[model samples]
Target: MRIGQPGRPLDARKDELILQAGRELLLRGGPLALTMEAVARASGVSKATLYRRWPHREALLEALVLREAQPLLSMLEGTPTDDAGLAAKLEAFLDSMLALMGQPGYRAYLQAIVALPQQQADLQRIWWLGPHQTMESVAALLRRYAAAQGRRWPAAARDAETLIGMAIGLEQARILYRQRPWRADARLRRRLIRAVVASFLGRRSAGIAVCEGNVGRG
Candidate 1:
């Protein structure tokens, strides 16, 4: 829906189609191929309609980012709390996130975002709304699941954030420095899922736990 921040209401259906077209073009040929005319052609919408809504390339890209984040948000809408159910849900999330982040489409999206002109408001929103919002959603889910299992969130919150950071960093390295394929092996994913549970349970099982003065940063 068109939740206009400060402007007149825009057509939600048209906005959705434009964003879908932009993402398709971006994933297919990277950022260079994303043009207003191409998107209009792909979406069967007029160029005037898109310009009236977006008015610029950067706005269109930001809209696409919101579109991309929608599916991720939906994935966390309903999560289970039981051990087995939670583990399954977490594994699914991790695997899906890994695959999505590792894809060429995602890499292209990141590249486009980084290359955008350095405007203060846009950069701030990119940081706060984009990545920070996504991280907060994940943290909330972890906190909820932990509480449901009769555990304190703050007790394991640090490790949980650190683990998420590790996963994100590993994926970033694969995209930036290393060209190696991301291996989401079943055994490794299962290990990560168990490690998350064990950390919350305060078990010092067979895993790396760097204790930083009473705080375990995994």
Candidate 2:
């Protein structure tokens, strides 16, 4: 019974091995396949070693998903360049998110998390909140961009949610259900990003129009 104590330094290499093994197991056999014994055997680490780091399978999976999502999540907090226009910033954000969700392995991990039983509420919450937080960060960026432009896009944050939902929803569906090779083509990706940005701007314009009409009639 090796208890994980505070200030206990974990071996980076060992941690990587364990996580990698966990991912492989997850991809091969879904969440059900991820057991402490299985991960230990796969990673060549003893079961005690695995337990010391992650007490249960859910803990291991949550950590693995967070580790993978952290890089993209960091980008959500990135400062846009002074000269980068809203469209450019939006394009960059969409590109990063698409790339992250487009990876087959990452998609599999997400699907596994989604498939978890409702009884595992904690794990499910952790899995869902990571992506939800990313979405909120994007909304914040949109609001910031609108402010920078000296324009009040009241719906900027809502539109941001729409943009993220559209991109991720489409890509995830295609990746999970469509039985076809989805190669990344730069041109197509750019087109998609442009369309999403245009949609957001268009929706903002419509919102402004409705507001103006309301004021005129008042």
Candidate 3:
């Protein structure tokens, strides 16, 4: 709850409350519904207090977006030492990401941010700091995980992005158009996971050192 003003000091307790209120407003109602006056009322802060910290809606929105995206950085933990481990980790990561995407709050927040005018600096900051950073971190994790297994990282990284994108893309589509659940059957899930892994291995791009000992493509 730093709000936009670094120089102006506020009590930590009040700041936390204001941030909490702002987050609730943004998540539950989307950006259009987020207003400084509304947040002040929600948080029981005076309008003067709200304005003193977050001067505009964009500033508050950006802060919340940053907070939301920060946790995604840790999604790469506990990657398996072998190919099975890697595939499992990838599946888990995709599942977690899809879950996030499917949340109503997340969907609304992303839609609001993306629809903002291109020249809006705060929105640009949100995009760069949040989803863009998550994508970069995911790509980096894929590269490193493959390398740890004595495999080439780039091809696998590419495939990882592709797979992750497919999952997210499909989920987003459902959110936008059909409002349908992204309910993948066992066969479909297996097919997607294997297809991505197969593409990487088939290309010999992962630089896997143990070709003879590990799982083979179908």
- For residue 140, model 1's alpha carbon misses the true position, in angstroms, by 0.9
TM-score for candidate 1, residues paired by index:
0.64
2 versus 3: better TM-score goes to: 2
The whole-model lDDT of each prediction reads 0.64, 0.70, 0.67
Worst 10 residues of 2 by lDDT: 1-10
In candidate 2, position 207 carries an lDDT of 77
Name the Cα RMSD for model 1. 7.3
Choose the strongest candidate by TM-score: 2
Deviation (Å) of 203 in candidate 3: 6.5
Candidate 3 lDDT score at position 70:
60
Clash pairs of candidate 3? 151-206, 151-207, 151-208, 152-206, 152-207
TM-score of 2: 0.72
Model 3 compared with the native: what TM-score? 0.66
Model 1, backbone clash pairs (residues 3+ apart or across chains), number: 0
Backbone clashes counted, model 2: 0
lDDT, residue 195, candidate 3? 70
